[model samples]
Target: MDATIEDPRLSTSVEVVFAKQHMPDLRGQVTLRAMAVSVVLGIVFCFVGMRIQLTTGLVPALNMPASVLCFFLLKSLVRLLQKGGFAVLPFTRQENMFLLTCVITCLNLAITGGFATALTGMTSTVAKTLADDPDPRDIVDNVPTGKWILFFFLIGMAGVLSNVPFNQVMIIDYKLLFPTGTVVGQLVNSFHTPEGAYVAKMQVMTIFKAFFGSFSWSIFQWFYTSGNGCGFQSFPSFGLGLYKRRFYFDFSATYIGLGMICPHIVNFGLLFGAIVSWGFLYPFLESKRGQWYETDSPSSLSGLNGYKVFISVALIVTDGLINFITLVTSAAINFYQIRQERDSSELTNYINKLHPSLNYDDRKRIEVFLANRIPVSGPVAGYIACAAISTVAIPAMFSQIKFYHVAMLYMAIPVVGFCNTYATGLTDWSVTPTYAKFVIFVLAAWIGRPGAVVASLLASGITMASLHVSSQAMQDLKSGYMTLTLPRAMVTGQLFGVALSSVVGPCIFLAFQNSTKPGAPVGSKQSNYPCPYAALYRAIGIIGMGGVKELPKYCIELCVISVCVTVAIDTAVLISQKRGWSIHSYIPSMTVIALPFFTGPFFAIDMCVGALLLLLWRRMEAGSAQLLSSSVAAGMICGEGLFTLPSVLLNMFKVLPPMCMKFLPGGQEVEVVDSFLNNSGASRA
Candidate 1:
């Protein structure tokens, strides 16, 4: 890497390579086109995604967060291409189309049936417990719309606060208007000619817009009233029918019910946090950590890849089982519905109960039976359970086990969430309304949940890693587009990102889990479920079966191997790419893809493979272009990071008094945190 030659005559290979990398004359129309292409592609994909959502029962996020993702990835690719040239941006339209189509299909399947994915792991566990019991299948079918709405509304309220912190962090990275700082001292270059709008018409449109926007989401829920099932369903029990509605529980969902949703950048931010905290700082915390920071800028923190892989393997395998369970759960429900339909008597009974003219054949009795027979449960703190489980597991796994517990902690929140929230529920991890009573089950079977934790960790880590890598790669991609150093930029990018996630980690704990739920104000949907875990315990009190008090050897062995895979995959990835790429990347993905294939099909694998291919293509580029590609990938992780950013910042508002001046006269002119990325900008620029 040392470019200076002792003698002018001693022209080294390093010097030659360095000169080629700094190509400046290539900038011109091509760069503009790349920018334009990125924007155009973003809009195109957005509309395509919207159309798909409308045309099919499938939503894009089922396979991928296609809408925002399209924008981020395309932008990253276009810039990478422009910097590295057209050849650097490889496109396999055949594979991409195939992948897209597959994703769409998977989206349909997932919406229709992919319950056992990364999001549904813990949730499915609870459902299974309920199903296994002889209790009526009422809870899932009879929740009130108001209650469902309230649960989500509270979750939304808890999450939206992250927006501010997230946006601030994002603004620091994206260089929104520019790739750096805000433009200042604008001269009157172009005159608007003081154009004025029709005041009366403007006011009316604004009023109408406000009204429609406020009620739009509510109105949209009408379509789902019929058993079309898009999170929460209402079944009329008494005179109506047994209402079995779902509450909101999208594993990858970053949206609040508010008009706004979490953007892709936040996903990148979360990734940024993981890379810095785990990938970067972790090694320093390790014996081999010197490789991460001891040498120089652009230091490859590839060492942490093992930690990621190790954790991921455990999660991926368990998750696959969880996904299979989801398929079975959905199939069971569908089959049960079909069986009910075949029974003329059952059909007649159901119809009569729904009849407007239910003759006095015991209408009061029917109402009473409906009231007590079925209780539709709302979204539970199952995902929170995964997070909490990770929180507990962190110290144990890392300190006692002496491998990489932090990685385990970080990975489990999302990965476990992905699995347990699914439908069928992993055999290892169970979910049932009755299981909700087993809050103490965790204390009993902490290790059993490691599989669950791995799933959650994957959810969190992959989300983070994908986002961080993509974003950093994107930034490095600018040929003359940026002047930052690749290694420096990578680290700096992570700093701003982790700063956002620091709060997200805990917010998920407090909000969705709502630690202060019982303390919530009167009438607040936030429950006063005094020791709901007691209920879980009481529900499972028969065998004391909630979490694993005694997991089978096969299950324990599987978890042990899974943990090994997690570390192995992370290590392989970290150490894999010496010249171009190392062994780590493909191994972890292989382990994941391989896990659930035998049990059932993961149609969404199509999209992921495509993404992997894209990642590979960028990885081969290996320089500026690689930087760009990784940046987009990192976007996924950052999205999660952005989730808690606002709360993190808001919590600091008290310390940042006279806040008005942050924007005023001589406020501290802040630069992008990635300034460390600049080979020369850390000082003057």
Candidate 2:
């Protein structure tokens, strides 16, 4: 008997490997209830995902939790309807997974389009600050609202269109192991068995408990504590503070969850980077550049922090370039090997080989079923139509960009999508920003124009959005593959999601914009949202367009040195791996190396704590460590993440009275002193 023909009843356990052989009837996989549930949840999560990104600079992949949530909700709804003697088929596993994927994909689209646009405006603010003649007005004032809207719309469309080809390449041909997708696949399959259902229920309950617990804690921490002395911070002295800063922990559940999911090497890498920047280099820089370092103002801290971010960017870029080389070389070798196998193998020569037992009609039916099982061209037409619309509409909508530039963007979509997909496959970090920067850099170098900054922003926005969508799409396809879901159903669900998010995301962003004081600078007191990612992207855009001249000389030097050190370390790891050294397995990831610096020491500290705790747990009880990590850690993440949306809404509506406690009066005093000094400096100038 073929291994693929195993009966489900005989199979005692559910596993992702089973998906390869377990082909189910695809006709009823996508039901009306599933689509309706998906649409409603997709819209809800779009707002939730956008709010989460805007608030915390993190977007929790909600597919797993949402899947469990949908299962329970739908089951309850069915039971209620059945009480009235109405016949309704319980949702199949495929329908449930499809619904969750739609919701998660839509949520991601919201974050990609809405959040990217918000970041663009925020980046413009940073650009003005860097200008010789700084402007006090909001950076978004210069760009027309219609142009911004149209730009976001095009980006969303591009992401949806490009995702199809990228998904086929990454999920089908390359067979990248999307870890999150695999986990989700396993989770959805668990609903089939009684024991699995019980486990799933527990997981759902754990998430709810953790979510409300964390949510309540967040409210108390923010409202009652006045947002002071909640997290550990460094001592104020320059000498001690440098070392102490690395120990700063925010006590966030989000970071703890991140640590639980991420590899130990990643956690160590983050800690190592934090130590290098805050413990050693920052102090050294302070001594060497006293005038630049000695400042009490919050803005000055941000300025000094830019050096650390620059170092991170340098390391990230260097690591990315090396990875790109390795990917290209490996791909060439793989292609050659595949070609050789195809030429030599008898199976490859036989195109229409069917079982001898099957009759002609049976063979034809099987062929048609297999062809429909995996969609090749139905989605292609939709993708092409979307691409065509974007190519034509973008230049017309945004006059700053020319037809040729838009054409160039269209040309680069496949390249960027492939690179990002491959990179994410390897590191689970989409170097979208880095690739965007490279795109902008090449374009700026070629154009050599004054509007280079604007061009860079626009190009980066489009590239990032497409890459974001492609990455998510590939991940979704992986989940579908693992769950034995129909490829066409997954594609259809994504299209519906993209369409919904395209509208929901922009509306949410526009609401925020309208609420902001008309003339107030973005990231100021009057503006409610602080966009950290936007700041990072803005810095990249400026550097891409204007080169090192846009940054301080010292920053340039730091960036160069950082890149050199990163390359050396990576090379050592590569050599060690080639020699099959066991110790080499622990080499840090570039994504982790740059995370602490970008997110701040506080975030790193929490993650480190979680990683260490998990390490200890594994040592104590190896068998249960996996279970504890997945359930408890995931609950913590969902709890904190879901709670933030309501928290933001409450704050937005002023449901809670303002509360302040001066736990650190000296910090306030220092702020006043900094304000006075800044005023004096301005007057003198």
Candidate 3:
């Protein structure tokens, strides 16, 4: 086993806590203290995930950061105990992987459990403003934290349980490379070694420095905020004229950090989308306001609001429907090929064929992994129970969703789960949002108007949560396979994470919900917590129920034109891929392009700035840029996100800033103040 590693992705050597591969056993590895630490880390990530979900609706891969932090803290605790003359077991790679599994699962629920998206999409705050004649029964007054926690827990549990049977097929037989999972395994294994620990210490310190800087900056920005739209967040970085068009920077460290973490294509896509919709389409639509619709209310559905909501909806739904069909077809063909390949050979022989391709350390890892087999009956029974309960209880909780609807959704879960998971395995992207969009339109059309809004939103939540958890479980399974962690332990850690996040996710979401006027009249650039996708999701439900009738004049035609354009773009990319052309990567994604239309173009500028910084860093020193960019970016993101809850609390307590800084078109501050005072006096008189 003392041979050099063949694959560039695999580590050079293997190390474990005990001399033997499985000496400590699964029970000893998952101790009480490890779980306690996992919960603490889970809360921190919950805060970060909630911030991303509400602001940009773009969450980067967090497995690497989470694993790094886990190792740093645990190692520090062990050394401190040793210094105090207390005997403690050394931290192991297995323990770190277990903690990572728990933390990541919780973080996923916080982001994708639909608190900021579909759930808020069904609320009265978003619905009434967007739709002309929204149904009273379809719009929920509020979803309390307690009830939301229970709802998330039920759906989350079902998602976790449904993916257990596919482990052998995806991991052992198909031998798919979940790149994120592999990176996480390599990180965990490397950190436990003496050489790897030294490198981790440097990364941890770098992260802390970046985190402190970001946190301090946010605190500084808070002191100058005297009133509505009176802080650095509203700075007109790109001249006042463009700022009026919602194209100025918001001075957000979180967004800058997110830009660094997100791929370059995503950043460029947001910019391109912003320029297309806000810069051109919206302006033209506004010019035709009086002739096309009316000049009565500024927020009228037959005016700019219709153009903003329905046009974006048309692009999103068209993109989602096309991708859904393509992915399903691809999955069907792949499954058929696999079945045919297996017909002439035994499954074990197929699994053994993967052995020669791997290095010595990976071979050892595989050996240790297959020894601790997970039971099928446990997960089977668990899924059946959760499915049965959810089928009955979900409809009871939300009246719009009937027992038949829940039954139909549950039947479709396995197929959607497999397709999503398979696609995730190949490319490190989760298309749950696309699947959720398709579900929203289908269920809305099935149930018809009035009640369709509530039913579609609720059903999408259930579908998204389940598919997200299933794909994530498969990824973690691959990580476990590489790190030699017990499959049973990995499953248990996932469940524990679901339990913790069931409470944490809801509580954080409620804090944001109550703290800010989410889904209110405040536009995406003006509001601190705009929850952009919620508005988009609600608009989709409305469109699904009303069709072209709900749209303004010329809007439906524009929608059709946008659909055809998107189809042409996707077709071009596919053809380019088959012809060995490298041009497909340059093209922006359809789903990402639709995002900035709803959220406004301000953040796109911030993200591009971040990508520019990364480019500059790479130009200076490539190695340091690759290693420390994510760590520094994550620190900045977490630092600002950590302050979000506290900032909300400060707002709730009626704390006010001492000074107000105003920026006007002509720099006539005194005139503005005098005009404000005169208006106030006239109102009183």
Candidate 4:
């Protein structure tokens, strides 16, 4: 390929020649069998994904890589059967990409549903904690089921619709790099060549082997370990008359995979927060405050919790402002450039200028292609209608909220969508939670104490879900653009996915909730699942609604300090970026900054281990590290995720005995021989 090309004609010619040489056999592209397989796998993966999130508080990406692997494995089986006197068809690359897109969309929805479940579950947990005489019934009764279902569907559809135009603008026109999506596109394109297919197949096999290894280990650890399903836990005493502080990592494959994908700076920042909160602040507070540290739990506060709350709030606010400003700045620069081009007739002259080697007809074809790719009127109208319906229906469904409140939320959707789209485009991190919290806070303040709680919760849920859906949709759109797939087909596949996931996700959440023990807080040992993210959001909602009066004095003080620190750090980074400093890339993202504050210190440690392993691997084997990392990391993730489904079921049904064995000095063992009693308690409670 040429390193430099200035003429549009030459660029078009190059792409045409390349396509002719590399295009895959398209016999099976976009067929009914492909759609069916995609839908089935999508539904199954979405259910499993939700289950994983609810149980472990980790969401797995079930997209191009995973889906492609699944497709080829199935294809291989079909080929084997055909050789054994049975006819079977092979899948095309385009069909695989389409199927992958569908699965990705569904996975996104499943995650959204899981988050919603966590949100509502945590709200109940919080309410119980706050109430003098807690009743789980009161909390459950208050949730309007019909209203929720309607709201979910409307918001989900609206999210899909609202993403289309932004997808076109950001992905097609501006060509923003959706990194993961780009990788998926490349993988799909590579399937055209035999070498690429062999590499992909090897990766698939590696992932399967890793999956089985991790899965088997999980069963042993969950059933046989002294901790009874818990990860490696340790309490190291500093011997300063302070109580031993708890520290442990959840040795799960999913988190390790996440570490592989995330930047080292992010993992380091998470570890940094954990060290500051648990290692330094917790110990220091124990010394000063004495018994207060001992009494405090993960959800409740000691001085450390107070500091975390304040710091998290500060980061959220600061990150939101910076994201908004960045979006506006980018827009302004683009507008200015476009204006200059139009004013100088540069754009038109450039368009009219043809390559000396090209004829007028070739130039006209290029012009027509560009014109055809622009957003059509039909899709624009459809999106507008969906948005309008959602805006009106949501407020009407819930009588507690005023119409104007919903109207304001509806108005903010487009703004939030654009900001989130741009933010993801620039940083590959969706700061939707920050934007959601900002919206919730504003709405809560406007609604006052009487309606503040409901307003904030509803606002946060809608904003978070919509933003998440739109961001993922745009990423898929980027993939579609790269693979030269029809936008309409991609949209239709996504809509099918959305429709199915909207129903499947909620059902899985409700079933999980019903099956689990009632009256237990989310993270408690007795509880069936832990939803750290939901708990974080719930805490934010409570603060937003109740205002500063609800916060402890220490928290307020720390919030002030956090503001100063966040501003200083952001300013320094901004200056560094302006000066073209490479170090700016190492700066921790808002997600990393906020993660340690909510989740346990162990998760940070687990992710750090994965990141460090990758770093070491890269150092030792620079050339092959890229391929090795993708296969191994993905295998580790998928292995744990796919296995969690059966493990959950086994635990639920009491098929596995609750027996614990200790190897450590202080560790003790518990053997529950009565299977009936164990199963009965879970069923009844």
The candidate that wins on TM-score is 3
Clashes of each: 130, 1, 0, 1
Q: What is the lDDT of residue 401 in candidate 4?
A: 62
Residue 643 accuracy (lDDT) in model 3: 83
Best by lDDT: 3
For lDDT, candidate 2 versus 3, the one ahead is 3
TM-score of each: 0.26, 0.79, 0.93, 0.81
User: Which pairs of residues collide in model 2?
Assistant: 211-639
Q: What's the lDDT for candidate 4?
A: 0.61
lDDT of 2 by residue, 1-685 (tens): 1212334344444443343443445556767777777766675566555654654355545666677777766666667778979887765677776777778777776776535433443345545433433333223344555655556666766665666655644553344567777677777777756777776777667766766776676565555432433222222223434434545555677677767766777777878877776667767765655555443333331356557557766777688777666665665665465446545535313222223342332222233323545455654576567667767777675544567787778777866676666656645656565566676667655655555555555666777777787777777766776666777777777766766666666666655544443354444322334454565554554565554343433777778887887788778887888798876678886756765565456556667788988989899998667654655666676566555455546657856526543323366777987799799999999
Off by over 4 Å in 2: 1-27, 39-63, 114-118, 121-124, 128-153, 163-183, 225-247, 290-306, 343-369, 373-377, 415-431, 507-530, 547-554, 616-625, 655-658, 665-685
The residue-by-residue lDDT of candidate 3 on 1-685, one tens digit each, is 2233345344445542333644557876686767888889999999998888787877788887898899998778778889999978767777788888999999988888887788877766676557556668778756667778888898889888888888877776677787888878887878877888888888888889999999999888888877777778778888788887888988888899989998899999999999998899888887886688874443446777877777788787778777767766776787677667766667655544535556556556556666676778888898888888888888888888998898888878877788888877876667788888878888888877688988999988999998999899889988888788888888888999899999999888767765553333322334576778887887677667764354578877887898999899988987898798999999988878999987889889999989999999999999999989989998998999898777778878887667666567765876887899899999999
| 293-384: candidate 1 lDDT, tens digit per residue | 24221211122322332233345434444434544566456446644644544433544543535333223223222222211221124234
On a 0 to 100 scale, what is the lDDT of residue 606 in model 4?
73
In candidate 3, stretches whose alpha carbon ends up further than 4 angstroms from where it belongs are 1-22, 295-299, 353-359, 517-526, 667-685
CA lDDT, every prediction? 0.28, 0.61, 0.80, 0.61
Clashes of 2: 1
